[model samples]
Target: MIMAWWQILLLTCLAFWMIIDQITVGILCNYPLLIGFVAGIIMNDVKTGLVVGATLQLMVLGVGTYGGASMPDFMTGAIVGTAYAVMTGKGGDFAIGLAVPVGLLMVQLDVLARFLNVFLLHRVDHFIKLNDTKQAARNVVYGVFPWGLSRAIPVFIMLIVGEKFIRQVLAVTPQWLTTGLKVSGGILPIVGIAILLRYLPTKRFITFLIVGFIAAAYLKIPMLGVALLGFAMAIFYYQKTIKSSEDHESNSTVNNANGKEYENDKGEYEN
Candidate 1:
């Protein structure tokens, strides 16, 4: 399964599925973590897959698309990253270095894909105007082709380029640059987190942030434990807030009833 055509085909199909799934079924197949896990399974290196995939996941933590905007193609990048990380055995750092640029490059391809979709939409409109339902439906379905191919073609080409090409590139790359890439890879998550915090209600939830930090740093709690702790805190706050709202509402209702029964200045009941 490692670096073979079938593996390449599977990875390419996964890339195709990632985009289409995002637009359609949305089973979270577009996430880097899942992409890496699947890529790792195909490459027979689940541990490496998780590491590389998780790293990429961190890199896109706060990244999202609004309106018609497209972000980096980290999902496809995860597929390449995991596959190459497994094949090269050069560690996740080196794989991270390779994966990121591919993501950036995909921004342009994403635009191209969107443009192609626009063209197809026009074709669909043309058919619709002519009252050709089948042609219009066919053109509508044809929109899948651009998006699917956008990721699939690059992934197939990258995978089929073989391990030899990657090794050869690595052989010529400077040691300092390679080390830098490793360091940069580790720092990427911090950048993502910084971006996320900037957009979040950090001041209001600063208590939770400090608690999470203490749990991870001082308590040395595992991520799952910290996550569970967060869940517990969320539930407590949610219930407390809901109860406060309900109590306020009840008090208001009682006040309104008393007001309704009270005598006005004219000695008449007023609502």
Candidate 2:
């Protein structure tokens, strides 16, 4: 697929907006799944976009940029991967292969963006002392440019490089390398899920977990059905737990009241 200038510009803009969205009005545009879906729509390949986004999203599950720490830029990976997957007509795994290095490389750019923003922060401080509120505010917005560009510039350049170049690179890539990518692509999500489970109270809800696994893996229940069942179970447990807590609190309150009454009555009789 020959990518038009408009498509490149649109995708670049989307990439630019995502980082700003992350720091400011976060509506989960920072998520790879949404990025991929939007990118796929731009490429006229929603399936590829969804597949790429979903795979990367799973891989990044339980991963965070907490406390200003940067994780791999999988969101960009989804955009590039979805675009190239559509353009190259390659498999989702091949797209994953293309995305892995790009995501890792973007990490350095992410750090660079933050480091550049430090200067803006300093300027904001200076303006605070000078009371030039407008310049400080402008600089604050200016700070978003580096962060946006860190993602946009690379995606724009890469997309403009065209499908011919991508096909050529794929032609030169070894079968073993591609195979490895497919395997790793599948494995990474499991690792992400494992990481997620580690932080969840899995032991307390082990039965639910076991049942879900059985329903999905053995019974081959549709994911939607499995999800609904899980929801029902969660609601049931939540209501039951609340009821028990309320009962315990009521009993405690009654016990305390009876004890106080007993003490008062005994003191009156002694008097």
Candidate 3:
């Protein structure tokens, strides 16, 4: 499963693009599914790419690098994992298992990139104080290098040398550990869901959750059907709540106006 030089170059470029897109453009090119698909195209294996990408996507869904917090780098995982999977003829499960550790390892790289960007920020600030507008703008553009290299260097190394490392590790690793890794991969997505639930109004949405679970578990409804049901419920709730609030406000306004008019009439009669 030797990767051609062009394939390695393409992957390196994808890695660079992912970080730059996240830090500057924010076009969601860093997302796992997209990364996987592009890697798949580069490797001439779209199906494997989709499977690997979707698996990583599910695992990291709803987990974000909000407030400068570091999370697993699923984008790198997807690109590397999909390439490895396609090259080695390993199934999606192995790719998924590989992704967890790869993503976790990438967290350090992400932090390093951010830390380096701080220096760039300082340089930009210095230029601003000197009133060098052109230099300040150039400094901002220069920040992209650290971020891009942080991702690209690791990806290039992995694509170039990772196959032999993976094969060697797989040969010596126990079967039980391998199975556990696969199981852990399957379970990791629940952590993402739990993180999402922490921010939700769980008590208010508990009933809907129960209904959805039942629909999926017992009634065997497809995910699309469940999603549509949820959408309908949201629309219904929004309309009902809005109408009730509007009616209450309208009634209050009318009653206040009528009471004022009655008071004026009574005062005139008394006078």
Query: Whose lDDT is greatest here?
Result: 2
TM-score of each: 0.93, 0.94, 0.87
lDDT of 3 at 164: 76
Indicate whether candidate 1 or candidate 2 has the larger lDDT.
2
Q: Candidate 1 — number of clashing residue pairs?
A: 0
Candidate 2 RMSD to the correct structure: 1.7
Residue-level lDDT of model 2, residues 1-271, one tens digit each, is 8888888999999889988898898886568999899999998989999999998888787777787798899889988998888887767987887887889989999999999999999999999999999999999989989999999999999999999897787799888988898887777778878988998899999999999999999999998999999999999999999999999999999999999999999999999
Report clashes for each candidate as comma-separated counts: 0, 0, 0
- Taken over the whole model, the C-alpha lDDT of each candidate is 0.89, 0.90, 0.85
Tens digit of per-residue lDDT, candidate 3, span 1-271: 7788999999999988997897777876557998888889999999988888887887766666678899888898888888888877867777888877888898898799889989989999999999999999998998889888988998898888856787887889999988886787677767767777887897888988898889889999998999998898889889999999999999999999999999999999999
**What ranges in model 2 sit over 4 Å off?**
264-271
Candidate 1 — what's its lDDT? 0.89
RMSD of each: 2.3, 1.7, 2.5
